[model samples]
Target: MSDATTISQQLGAAVHQNGVMNSTGVLERLFSHLFHGLVYPQIWEDPVVDMAALNLAPDEDLFCIASGGCNAMSYLTARPASVTAVDLSPAHVALLRLKAAAAQHLPDQAAFFEFFGQADRQDNVEAYDRYLAPHLDAQTRAYWEGRVLGRRRIAMFARGFYRYGALGRFIGVVHMIARLGGVNFTPLLKAQSLAAQRQFFDSQIAPLFEARAVKFLARRRAALFGLGIPPAQFDKLARDGGGDILPVLRERTRKLICDFPIAENYFAWQAFGRRYGGAGTALPPYLEPAQFDTVAHHAHCISVQNRPMTEVLTRRASGSLDCYVLLDAQDWMTDAQLNALWEQITRTARPGARVIYRTGGAPDILPGRVETSLLNRWRYDQAGSEAGFARDRSAIYGGFHLRRHEG
Candidate 1:
């Protein structure tokens, strides 16, 4: 088998063994591994939505999963007292570390932009080998040393940010499929008017859902599962649009494709255009610079462990964390796991600590749990949380926000 396939197989086996995909859990292990190990730390849920949900104070110390590290670095812009980012995947950890190194050590903002936004420039490997390589921790250094398609190293984003890696290739394939369907989505890059953009969505994109190819693809439980939807979540996603998931998915895809200028949205640039920062301003951070120093400074506060969420929480100090940002991770847990996680959160959370997560449907998954006196100290912000949910475009989650009450 090819090296890429080998890696995927190994990862799949590891995920299955880890109980990440047990049938009784809320999340499918295989799906979570694919999303977290492969799809995430590339194009993930938007930081803007995360920022809105976090409502972080300038001085609050924060802890979050580093998925792609974009949100971690973006959190720095808010001038938080500190931000700790953690992730289980080594690839994600390496990427986050590299970004942190670059953000802190890079010469200037413009050069930083060029390196990350214009990653196709060809000099990026040298830049990493020269300026960034020596500083990388051994693990991250070894990660970049690994080859892509037998190429020596994956550090060649300088030639083009979108030209390398599995994520890039995945986006390319999606774009190719969309193109084959007779939807000329390229104009989305230059759409200056919302009217024009909306026109594109209504005309060329939305109709794809009703197409045989899309519907067929959507019906496959495995295919949807690969997008990180577990069986329960698959049901929720299907029910959210009043029993027709195809239309809802199509509309969301249209938003990613036609709602914003490609330059402004790294997700679209990566998904439909196969290049980031085509119009000059860098796409968001994950696709921006591969090295981020600002994210690293807060790295000490972040800790990545192979253990499950319940285990991670049990080890933390009580009443210490102010916010818990669980990125649909709960969807992968069992009732026992859920109860265990909440027990830790309740013990460790200070009064007024906030917990946020996303689900696969319009309704909150925690109403029964949160309302019961067992974990009832946490109250739900039904209205505000719903508004936040509606605003999220990832369309992969049903959003929720919970606040801990004072005793």
Candidate 2:
């Protein structure tokens, strides 16, 4: 069968555990099919907070889930010994590989930025052909050169790539809904202070969540699949919201807008403007001009793999890994899956190793779920986790947990 079919099957195995005839099982299968393609053009987790939580040393090797490859690339700035980024989706694997190749082969920061930073210029398609295409592996080359709806997939960069992915389209629909309600988000981006940001949110954005249509959509499990939230995570979020997700969503949006300055939060730019804030403002660490050389120089340190995190760790030598970045993935895991993952993690963790993950609810998901023996091998840093959660620019998750290997 094709790569897409294989990926769908793999994802189905991981996501669909309930009875096939049950509503939960059906929704899980639907999400896996949708996720088999490109879901996150820009990963929602903030890399700045991730790097801080990881606190990697130059000798430390890191492993992470490669959801758009943003955090993996950004980790290069910390000068880690290596970064192995694994994912279940072949599309995400191709995207990350393409990015790593671009970082090394592309001539300069402006050229790289024009391709990914502007992300809506026609020149990028030509740039890909001239510079990045030949360097990519056959599968990756085919993925970009291939057509979607009769348009070359690489042309997505020329036509605004960030607006085309599952999450991007979700944001676009949110904007459309706001427009229908006579609300505009552009003003929020121009706000000079947190006070102004709150004012804009209170006046222009907050009321939109209360609309009957908005509330109805927020209640539907399918509606949030666009946000990359699975049924398992949806349940956690609903429980946190007292069985109504609207309040949870409203509070998260408010934190995204008012908790950080626009000039300092790139997540806000993507959420509100569908693009980065540009040169003087916020950008992912890897995309910043000053750090471009560092990322490119260390780009070879990153390796992309299409597989589950547990499988990758299982093949690794004992005490081989120093850091792990699990971005809200545990919320989707069954107890057995959680135990299996942590077993490998505990076995592979080196001295002073750290692991950071986020959850849909305010508390960490591991304490009561994973095997107690496996979990007792690590010490959870509650204060650092709360601090990390507070500083996370994305502000979409409820908790950020950091654990240190006790061995």
Candidate 3:
């Protein structure tokens, strides 16, 4: 399939191109296409929490799904020997490649910071053309340069890139819902303490749930298309939410709002404020000045492949990789696909290799899908996963799983 159509093909059977709309048929494919179009402009999982579980070393090799390239770039600060960003979406691969190129070739930390840290700068287009453009591969170059909706995709840098992707648009939609329900969450971002945050959630944000529209949208999978929750995963979400997803959403939102200090939580900043907190002390590690040199120096360690996770792992040498950051991709896979993935991970993972992933809903994904014989090679760190899930500042995932290769 061409890059243009890979998304629709990759999400095959999930969305019906010609099938008529039944209760289930029409919406599934439409959502699959929507999700595949712009799944995450900003990664939803916390790389800080991910790094803690992976315990990356200077010599360790890392394999990660390069969603938004945040964690891929952030992992450079840990001094990993290699970080491979394997993704299926052409858009995601292009974005990751762009970040890697920018981090490497941008003149100085300040200019670099302006390009990505403060991405809404008007000079970003010039910066991209002058410095980063030459460094990008042919496919990645075409992606940014290509016109869509009568504008270059790279034009988003000047017009607020962070607020454009599926996740970004989803946040915008939520803000709209909140406003229609008579709640303005901007005050929540300014809350000085957890007490104030909680106070706001209860008094203001909480009432949105009581609104008939909000509740109705919460029950409908189509309403969550922006969050990248697919039809199958939506079913899983409702099931794990005890057949009603409102309380689950409330708990998750509460975590996003109050469980972490706003000063330190970039996810909260993006969710409530629609921006990174700032470039000061609270920025994503990869964007901070202190970490800039390390990330730039090691940016060459990263590589992007627009291929399925299974295909990327298939050609790799056994016992090569030391860390795996799957994000929530596994939530969409079938039992056979899950087994095929672990088979390669098991073969390629080095001793003491740690695999970290998130789930839409869970106990865990591997119990019946991946056979015990294959799974026995790895040790599931239940306690660590629970701790990591709680520590995940993103607050969007149901569970964070940590598995170690004990073979």
Which digits, one per residue and each the tens of the lDDT, describe model 3 over residues 196-298? Answer: 8889888988777888888998998788878888776777778777988887788889889888888889888888787787777557889988999999999
The alpha-carbon lDDT assigned to residue 167 of candidate 2 equals 93
User: How much does each candidate deviate from the true structure in C-alpha RMSD?
Assistant: 4.9, 1.1, 2.0
Candidates 2 and 3: which is better by TM-score?
2
**Candidate 2, superposed: residue stretches over 4 Å from native:** none
Number of clashes in every candidate structure?
A: 22, 0, 1
Model 1 lDDT tens row, 105-192:
6665555566666766566677677778898878678877887777745446655655544465545555666778887767876777
Cα distance off (Å), candidate 2, residue 8: 2.4
Best by TM-score: 2
Q: How are the candidates ranked when ordered by lDDT, highest leading?
A: 2, 3, 1
Reference-based lDDT, residue 406, model 3: 92
The collision pairs in model 2 are none
